[model samples]
Target chain A: MTTDALALPMAVPAAGLPARVRIHEVGARDGLQNEKATVPTEVKAEFVRRLADAGLTTIEATSFVRPEWVPQLADAERLYPLVAGLPVALPVLVPNERGLDRALRLGARRVAVFASATESFAKANLNRTVDEALAMFEPVVARAKAEGVHVRGYLSMCFGDPWEGPVPLPRVVRVCRALLDQGCDELSLGDTIGVATPGHVTALLAALEEAGVPVSALGVHFHDTYGQALANTLAALQHGVTTVDASAGGLGGCPYAKSATGNLATEDLVWMLRGLGIDTGVDLGRLVATSVWMAERLGRPSPSRTVRALAPTVASPASHKEQ
Target chain B: MTTDALALPMAVPAAGLPARVRIHEVGARDGLQNEKATVPTEVKAEFVRRLADAGLTTIEATSFVRPEWVPQLADAERLYPLVAGLPVALPVLVPNERGLDRALRLGARRVAVFASATESFAKANLNRTVDEALAMFEPVVARAKAEGVHVRGYLSMCFGDPWEGPVPLPRVVRVCRALLDQGCDELSLGDTIGVATPGHVTALLAALEEAGVPVSALGVHFHDTYGQALANTLAALQHGVTTVDASAGGLGGCPYAKSATGNLATEDLVWMLRGLGIDTGVDLGRLVATSVWMAERLGRPSPSRTVRALAPTVASPASHKEQ
Candidate 1:
């Protein structure tokens, strides 16, 4: 690479932000799940390894959903053991007790459960009411805690819902409180449709804090549908959120939402974090290279502005291959 | 368009931000100047008219640089007359006294002179030393002000430069003060390389404030090359900047910098501003339609994430044409 190709942002620290941020990389699981084509099991394994090698400490490996439900992640049983020995944290998604049981049998130490703040998504995604979905997750969280596995609860539609217009702050707070009450270690507040603005993010964080949920246990998962993810992430960081969920190369869109875009790109987030003088322990060049490779494999360019700008030659051509 | 295609962000106001912002639209001038294909004069005129109809108060029409220098906008004389009847502020760029004379002859009321923060960009872009470029702009600003015309000074490379790395705060302050001292009414700080982060944005704004430059007279022009523009714009807004410069469809990339990307998309900026309950008087649907129309003329998909997510059916197919 030329010196120009590897140009990094100059460090200039902002006040009222954490000194270091922990990025929960979700490309292998949340990202690939939404792809039209199912990737091979080994490619998924190698993707996780590359993310870890790029200095990401927490990588969500794959979902333990029933193979028929989400066929893309059906190889969870086969995929978990391939990278179980990596030094980084690999959190797999577990839909219920069955999913958790399958994950634990493969020696997975970290797991996440998906929940919804809106009732419509709960019914559609889980085939159960919001309360019933929580009840289904009750035993999964308990069992994961009992086995000393770290658990993360993903609360979707925290900002807006398609069927329901704007979700009330109190309604979202209730779901977040319930997840915490169920012994989940961390909560990732998701903007499933990417309709969130900075003020909305700050308001939600404040509401959660008032409900006695500490900022330390909260992470933000934003999509870029309206191009508000990075701005919203900035608001969350200023509100003391240190754990950010991002997908390498901005990999996936919400499978349920019609207008949803991909998750906040990891490389985009890293560029901002590095510029703020916040240490993410990520090597951006390696991360961009990895995203380029993944985009080539996916036969489409990464939907990441940072990835495209940094690796223009490789990224621009991938779009041609899509034709 | 279906109601789903017209999905708008729910308004939630943030604390300490201006109630309304003035968007200085630059797609006609700064945006198209970098395009390899020369957009027809009538098409450029229509883009401006559509922007005005969409509630943009200020639209940059075109530059008055030597025709040979910017062949894409070589028909500036023919273009200005076509859009001059629009009831909006059309600020055209004037490089020096000669360019200023041409704009004045065309009855241009508002004109902007380009200045650079670093010595390298000063030499590369203007082919003059930093002071020499300022010397050339001094007469143009005085002449325009003396004729009761509005003058804006564009200071490029405010954050970082390609030839020289991170630009120092004092150097930027010096050039800004020079432009203001030369009778320029407003200053647009350009992050030409898109390497700026929020802290750096806040720091620069604070420094400019300390140098007796009010936030009211300052505008921010950010590129999304590194995906930092919106986050940085949020920082500037928090620091009380009320004017922002954006292209209609994330239209232009820096011709001087190899790794640069387009300016922040006006649609992306409007999405965040509207979501924050900050009014720009812009109709998002009309704006998206306008960008979509322009992107078709350019024969490329807009770099704006909001445009792609909202107009997926129209935008996704444009890539096939590239092949």
Candidate 2:
């Protein structure tokens, strides 16, 4: 385009700022946990290693839930040993003190406490009220913090709840405040059912700010069930939330969710960031190929549009649009 | 959200402004033209009537193309008569002078002309060069004008060509200008392969503006291939473009363009508009239900996320946080 064209009223800036955001790879834990087929522990470990090699700084290795609840991730013990000693930080999900005990015994340096913002969701998912769940996390956070392990708290269904209706912003703020007060170094607000619009993201973040939660203590996790995940993430990034949770190959769909939609694909996120001149250390081609490999292993096509669009065909890539 | 939290930045003004925009529903024409199964003419006529009932003033009815090429829409003759005398402005696509002759004989009051920006695509689809295709439209546009009929020009492959690589913005602007100069009342820019990004949309519209084409004279047509169609359309709306072209159920995908994805679903576009408080005069739930019907007829679920999420579940319109 000519310089005259770029000078239009809404001219796009070069956006030279580094996309220094950290992507916490969640495919290993959140992704495989929902799969019907159990991925081998060695395969899960290799997935983590590949993700780290692709320049991801953090990886949610595996959840320590009971085997009866999540048979796919039942071999977390075996998987944790193989992924140990990686340079990247590994955080595992702990539903309660028992799950925390498993991670702590396994030498976990970081652990995440999971809770939902809605009473119905919390009751259904964790089988406890919000207060009771927060109360249970008190011991888990204290133990992990005393052991010098960072504790990250997750508030799921913060935007919209399935059993109930629209979650009140005050309720979300209270949950965020509770998580912060309970010693979570950072809080990742999850649109667990992927019903969030950009406006919802902005409104929730604004309420959090008003509640005196520092922006630095926040991350955003989005599902792509409604196809607003990327747009919602952009809203969060603009609000200065630096950490994002994404599943590789967009592998995971929420077990509680009815739709077959995929999570936000890491390759697609990296592609958008790179286009904006954001510096995500993750290599796009390698990540795309790795995601394709994982999809092959799961006997499914990759859920990522970017991966599918970028994969080679009989026609050359150059034949496709450069944009 | 609190008052302070509610007041966020604005790129586009709320739709309550004095300016009234028009939405041209292309579901019946551009949408079904590419369907695998031939839609009965009665179904096509009923779909047009439903769209008109949904407050869509401009509904594209059918294309006067050869039955051998587009078998799905081969019964345009039968369908056009069914929608005749409707209060809505129903336009039909005319491929050439021969097609225009058929439309004129059928008393088509409003007609649309088509041209491609890329030579390869022009040759592949229309069996002509880019210049030849535009030249072919010159007579069609003239005949429509002489017959006191309104003419709209469709410039396909504006952002990227499926056969050739990147289509330069200058080339797209030139084609758009030529079509406008050919006595067409409006210009519709199509991302036929769905390769457009917001940056591309911004840059191209800016180029058109710099070329002295009134932004209000342009409409946007996007496909959801990269999942950026809505975002790209939002970027266009930020400019003064008042019209957008969309297919119901995300119905249109180019069969000639291998791996090309679905068009921007009318339901999805309506959802975004309603979220932004823009008045498209289209009923969200009814549009979604109609799209679901279309999808069922095709024996395929919709390619639109909004239709899939809203229909058969969301009983009421959710409140918009932005509003």
Candidate 3:
């Protein structure tokens, strides 16, 4: 890449923003889970190691869901242990008691349970009602906490749902309270459909605060289906949310969502945070190189605008080494 | 498209934002200027008409520069008369007195002069020093004002320059003041290389305000090269600036910049504005259709994330009719 394209933005810190942001990297698990092809277990482990090398403190390693459910991430058993010895946090996804048992058996220290804020998504994604799904996650979270493991509750469809149009604020707040009450150490609100705007983001954070959920305990996971992810992220930062979930190379779309777009790209998030003078502890050059390498492994160009812009020479598969 | 994918974000107005935003549509001028393939004059005229039909009040029609400098927009004279009778305001770009004369000959009521904020960009883009370029625009702005015509001054490279790195705020403010002092009706601050962040945007606007420029007299023109345009636009909105410059369907790239990404997509901007309950009088569905049609003419998909998500089926050439 030319020096012009690789040059970082000038740092100018804004008011009412945190000095540091903890980026919850989700590329290895949430990103790979939606891929059609089966990535090798060794490749997944290297990807996590590369992410940790790029200075991301928390990287979601793999999902312990049943192999048939998300075959792309079926190698969780082999993947977690490979990256478990890293200095960074390796959080894995656990669907229920069975998944929790499998994860705990592998000596996993950090785990996240996925929940849905809307009824339609809960039924469509989990084949259960919202309450039933929460009932399933309650034990998983409680057990993890009892084991002194950090628990994260991922509340999906918090902004808009595909089957149900605009999700109500109270509906999302109730689910968030349920997750926190069941002992989730933190919560990641998911905009699965990516229909959220800045005002909706601000309003949701405010409502959650009014409902007794601390802003410090909340992280936002916004998809870029409508190109509102970074803008919504800025609103969350303005509201004192220091944790943001992003995927490397903008990988992983929601299989159930109508749009095929995925989570906010970590490279894009890092560019903004670095420009805002917020400490992310990320080496942008190294992070971009990692995404470029992963994009080659996927045999497709990255969906991230930042990745495409910063690493134009190596972004496409035909340009360099083949998978 | 499914209704779920076409769903609009819920209206949740935020505090400290303007009640309405006036979008300065530049697909025909700034957007088309960098095209390698020549779009037919008839297609350009129809694109402006479609943008007006989508409820954009101010549309920049074409630039009246020498044909050799920008062969893509060489049909400015032919394209201007075709869309001049529309109800919306059609502003054309003029690089100098000669270009301004050509525009005035066509009874143009609104014209814009493109200026550079940094010395390096001024030399590279205008072939003159910053002061020399300002001196050139002074006469052009005066002539337009004497004719009772509205003039917009575009200050490019206000945030970062390719050769100069991050531009100082005072340097940008000085150029903005110069443009206003020369009797320009409004100024559009251009992040030509798209390196701006929220804090930088806020800082630049505040600096301009300190230099006696009213927020009402300014517009923000952000590029999405680094995926920060919408966030920077949000910061501009939060600062109470109501005018935003966007390209229809995310057409146009800066041929001078290293990255090939273009302006912030109008559909993306409208999505955020509509969600914030700020009136821009745009119909999102119709706008997406217009962009899709223009993308077909360009023989490429639009760079806009919103256009891709909203009008997925029609954004590609193979799916529908051939140009």
Candidate 4:
């Protein structure tokens, strides 16, 4: 919002875009869990702290999946208390009652339940059928609500699954309704394979709205795997859906970090939103600095185009002659 | 377009989206020219041949710039005739009458003149001021028209120049009008530094339209350095512009390829257009293959997210054990 000379080129906001969007930062949980290296518990906590200091109001702290399933996040128990005092809503991923119990013990305020719209992705990710996974989350959601916890349902593969291609909108709507009916306060429709386009997003949001789910209760989770994440997010925003999930620096969570272009980079989204004159309450400069810090720790450049653009001196070590 | 299961997970065409878009393939000219390695003359023609085979109707063959200025595209005279027989419009870049003379002798049906919109870029790239560059191309465009060769004008830095913060929309409109008035059939607006967002694209397109430059005469050239190319392109598409300039596999020509993340990848654009159910005559599979082929020659992976997504096995050699 500062008229700083280096700020992104700002323009008048187009009609239909949200005046302000809430970015759900998933760097700690989704970004790191997939990373090849196990970030120290202290580093993970610092990552959360930096994200909050950068003006992020909602950050997914860590996932409570079994250590056997996600060894990288095995230190979630250690990660939780470290970030508990940050002045932000730190959410954690909880797949079942056992994971919910872990989050409850950590005094977590927000928890997200992960589900899939396709049978193949369900079986592949959760080792269960789609219906079985939904059934499994019922008890967890109930207990979380009973304990006054806010629940966010994540519908992975809501757009397409690697194994299933394009998921039927009706199936996604059905799963979404079930999650909302089961006490989830909101749903994050995920394009797990990064194959979604803006038209598909508009059509799907319309279907979800027609099926009686308010647009207010929906957020979008996209992967930049196909590079349409920002465009897809724009379509969703134009549909009046305000909350979007992004990972800082487009992190793939790979410790080796050769191919780390998974989640939409938060800096990219903020750049677009800020340029369109929309408010996100997030500071682009601080976010880029955070990614730069994390990339150093990971021993690789941040794959985020926005982060790299803002901090170009770090992306390439070689020099270019300036005219 | 086929109901074949692999047709991009397309939704019904949304309102305001063009049913069909003409993709101007720049892989051979814009892509390879900035590449660090000087691709063989035969391979340059082959790249254009492949792009046309992939259903690209407009492929810019090569630039007729001085060999000393662009050694990589030094074979433009050698490259033209090889692709002249193709059932596509082969446009070559002609900076002035000398370059136009090379195209004329080679029987080029279509040629493009490169101009800079900002004074700084004009002086740096064309070694002339903005008006001086426009004046320099006036006769080149006129002579090309007299010879019955269609001329396209490229106005670089239409949005922002690296040395200049944001080029005024009126300035872009004036340059665009001058080109169109100078007998140019179409003008492609180039965000040479890739700093534009959808909002800026929208505003600029609106100003251009208001200045009486028909939307049909406008094409957008974007760089993904900040990862906003597709989004900016979408804004132009929604404004009813039909031509889009893209390089296969996101190739950045090395004349300054080190800074060339400014062009949108053809595959990434196709994925969005196809998913939007917008008919682009280009084939996604064939385009990805072309990029993959070029990447091998370049000894690097394609920077395209769509190509990387389609050819994931090579991109992520690290295995993810399937259930």
Candidate 5:
């Protein structure tokens, strides 16, 4: 580039950065669901409580899917009552009519449905085609909306699919629009295989707008499998995405994606947002503590860099970004 | 942000991304220096050869500091003449006039000098004050320049110092200008503790330009301690930087910065740059293979995410971005 071009204002100006961002904590549901060990119901309860206490206003408490499908989260029925009283919007994942029935019976105030932007992922994850899966979620979202329950829609493999190398932009936009059209309040675009770069993110967000989806109604869920999650998040934020989905402690990647690793860690995201002078409301120190405690239950150290840098044994803790 | 704001172009337009980036491979020098085990002279020679074969044109071969200071690169004289015939720039680190004398006797074509942005880091790292260290290097740079050898200057802890919280911008800018004014061809700003985010990088680059330092003479060396390396690199590239410093397989972090982990992996950088259509002329497959091979020699798996996802054990390598 010419020296003159470098002097021009950067495309991602500080003014384009979001002032306040809402983090949707998905560790309780998405993170624990992928773990080999069945996290104790009390442990799950405490995780949600800690997440809410750490200032995560939208905490996905549990998934109401069947025990046969994901046995790890089979205790959702017992876990829901534990965190239902917290001063947070606890959204539980509801897969079908059966999952929605379970949530409605438990007086779930908020629920989320997962849709696939790729055909193979829909078949492998939902045992149905993409259209059939969306058709199945329509009534669940409509009924939940009728009962005064808010709904969120997650479109998996938005950027790249495990089966399809790169999901077409129109495929993601179609699924996102269908979810929002069917009464879902917000849609999160997921890069299931974690193959997205910033350019793909910006272009996809632009295409979603071209499809008539409002920017405020869209959030981004990126996996750190390729180390692009935070960078992609910055790109999305630059393009006006105010809501972001993060797993506390970099908890979960899609179990169905097989090769995908952890989600973007909330601590890592909070660190960047704080440095950018954006408000995330969540306390970073408290968030790292929560992840460290959860990692102990799994008998492993947290994979989060922020958590690693701030852990008790880390010297010069006073100089760390968290401190 | 409003829906209308989303319609606006992203801050980093695709056209603004760099078309070609130079990869300054630092694995042989910086990577092995931090390693606990001493690599043999022959192994270091083979490593440099493989890096050049993988299309890295500028590979930092070794450090010419006192043997007692860094025993890892103690065979600099033997190692230099070994790969001196390769089609690459082998720039060894010359700490002072004594080191410059050693390089001059050995017919070194390119050399680099180190400076510190903070006084605490200077004393801690170089056992000298910032000005003292610069004064010590001015002669080395002048001697190297007199011999028609290209010199590159490195300013460490430019963003955040472990002892000092955040190094002031002017402090970094002043050191940077001093280095460039002393006849160094390029200045590589080093985030020794790696706490910088994209916003800080943007502001610093802008500040440097305002202080009359052209972006053409700048390169960036970021550590992945906080997982912001790739994001910060994107911000730098958007600001028109065509040169980046990365270690193969994410090899090294400062041994002094207890919290810092791996250097930004060249494979990871290539993955993102390739996705953004930026060319760095490095064969990522060969690079990952080289890293995996080096990891075997070091008796550990690489810390790079791209390497982990593209390793032989990974199930779905076909859909991987690296492949």
Candidate 6:
């Protein structure tokens, strides 16, 4: 990208400053986990390799959750070893010490912890309250730190909860701080149901900054259920957050969350960032193409409007016709 | 709307400030024009009434174009007189002197002339080149002015043309200037294909201002084709343009522009504006309900994501059921 293209002429506000955003592709883990059919282990690993080959530095490999709870990702244990040390840090979703232990044994060096800011989401999703879930992660965080494994904390339902109404900003800030204090290197604030607007993101981020939280240590996960993900990410980027979690081709929606749609597509996010001259270092065309390929494997077209409109050749007409 | 809420604390450079923003609700005209099934004139009048009731003070109530071009709005002549002296000013879309004469005969005090920024879109859509189309509108605008009718000019394909990649900014500015000099009360820049971004909106508005076009006389018409409509609208709002063009439930798309989604939804725009504390005088629930009612008439769901997600008792179970 040209320096001239990146430079914003005249003085703009600091809160509105364009960010150099990096998208962490999470299709294999967070995306496919909610799929109706169980994706094969090789297919998951191949998806990871394709994302890695497309210049993605971080590809969430798989979740180590129990098979009974999430049958879709039951092959996590079998998939990890095959993708070890493939020029990218494969972060696996781990619920507790046991999951982390299993991931560590598979040669994993990065792990992500899942928690919810709302009590109802935590109970429905993990069968625990917010405090109970956090307590379970305390030991896992220490163990990961001792093993030299980086930890990332995902705080879901940070904006609005289905059972309850608008989530309090203070609660989100408190959970985020607790996760950071527990030794997680980065905290991703998730709008799991996609109810957030740019103003909500701005207010939440501003509240975080006001509470003395370092904005640079933040990441964002957004759902496109309400079609506000990309705009919300722009708001997050303006607040200086670097890492963003996205699903390839906008894959993945919370099956349990009736109002949920897909996560923000990596291609759409990359396209927006590139237009703003933000260096994401990912190949747009290749990333879009990979989503097209994944769409074929799942027997569906890619959910991302950008991928569908921009790259229509990932799967043959016959393959699409099979569905 | 509180003063504090409207303060866009997000940083934006001074040079990036957009010249102006205008909103034109096309629910009655362009939105209803493309419906395959005939919409009752009473329904169209009530639709316009509900839109104006929700603080949409400027509405495109009907079109005087040839019935062959748009049979859905063929009742424009009868509909115009029935809805006269509404709380808001009604703008009727006129294609040529004949349509302008029809509108004037029906007591239309405000009329809009449609032209394109590209030769290809102009020829394909209006059956004339850019210059020839403007020439057609020149006499119409003069006749409308003689009849004391306020004339608005619509410049389609302002950002990127479908046949021509990345429309030159100068070409856009020239069309805009010509419309202004030809006595257009305001100019609506249209991303008819929905391929524009916030950067493109900002650049185009800036270029227009640099070309000495009055910012207050500028409005925006965007399609959600790429899901950038709201963000692009925000960029325009930040530039101080107050008038924006939206369809109830994002209701319209150019039939010639294949794959183009609906226009920015009136419900979604009102939602975002309300969240930003921008007083649009639009009622979210009423706007959503009206669109949902209209969608049923069309045998489809409303295209607005906000309406789909936020409105209760409006979605058909089969609306999103995968084929």
On TM-score, the leading prediction is 3
lDDT of 2 at A250: 88
Interface root mean square deviation of every model, in Å? Answer: 2.9, 10.1, 2.4, 6.6, 13.0, 10.6
Itemize residue pairs with steric clashes in candidate 3: none
Q: Could you tell me the lDDT of residue B23 within candidate 6?
A: 55
Candidate 1 C-alpha lDDT tens digits along A115-148: 9998989988999999999999999999999999
In candidate 5, stretches whose alpha carbon ends up further than 4 angstroms from where it belongs are A1-13, A313-323, B1-13, B313-323
Model 3 Cα lDDT, one tens digit per residue, B1-323: 24344457889999999999999999988898988888899988988988998899999999998999899989999999999999999999999999999999999999999999988888878899999999999899999999999999999999988788889999999999999999999999999888899999999999999999999999999999889999999999999899999999888778777684889999999999989999999989778888998887788888888888888543444543432
Residues A237-287 of candidate 6: C-alpha lDDT, one tens digit per residue: 766788889999999988656657789889877766665667777887678
lDDT of 5 by residue, B1-323 (tens): 11111111122236587778998999999888988788989988988988998899999999999998998888998999999999899999999999999988888899999999999889877999999999999999988999999999999988887766767789999999999999999999998777888888988899999999999999999988778898889889989888899999899878777777888988888778877877678877778778887887899989888787776543233433331
Q: Which candidate is the best by DockQ?
A: 3
Q: After aligning candidate 5 to the native by TM-score, how far in Å is the CA of B146 from where it should be?
A: 1.7
> Which candidate, 3 or 5, would have the higher DockQ against the true structure?
3
Reference contacts preserved by each model:
0.53, 0.07, 0.67, 0.53, 0.31, 0.11
- Tens digits of per-residue lDDT for model 4, A51-105: 9988999999988999988898999999899989989999899999999999999
How good is the docking of model 2, as DockQ?
A: 0.16
Query: Can you write out model 1's per-residue Cα lDDT over B38-145, one digit (the tens) per residue?
Result: 788888988898899889999999999999889998898999999889899999999999999999999999999999999988988889999999999988999999
Error at B137, model 3, angstroms: 1.1
Pairs with steric clashes in candidate 5: A11-B11, A12-B11
Candidate 5: docking tier: acceptable
Least accurate 10 contiguous residues by lDDT in model 6 chain B? B1-10
lDDT of 4 by residue, B61-144 (tens): 889999988888888878888889999999999998899998899999999999888887787778998898888899999999
For candidate 1, the per-residue lDDT at B167 reads 92
* Model 6 chain A worst lDDT window (10 residues): A1-10
Predicted complex 3: CAPRI docking category: medium
Least well predicted 10-residue stretch by lDDT in candidate 5 chain A? A1-10
Give iRMSD, candidate 3.
2.4
Model 2 chain A weakest lDDT span, ten residues long: A1-10
Worst window of 10 by summed lDDT in candidate 3 chain B: B314-323
Question: All models, DockQ values?
Answer: 0.49, 0.16, 0.62, 0.40, 0.25, 0.22
Output the chain A TM-score of model 5.
Answer: 0.92
Please give the lDDT score for candidate 3. 0.90
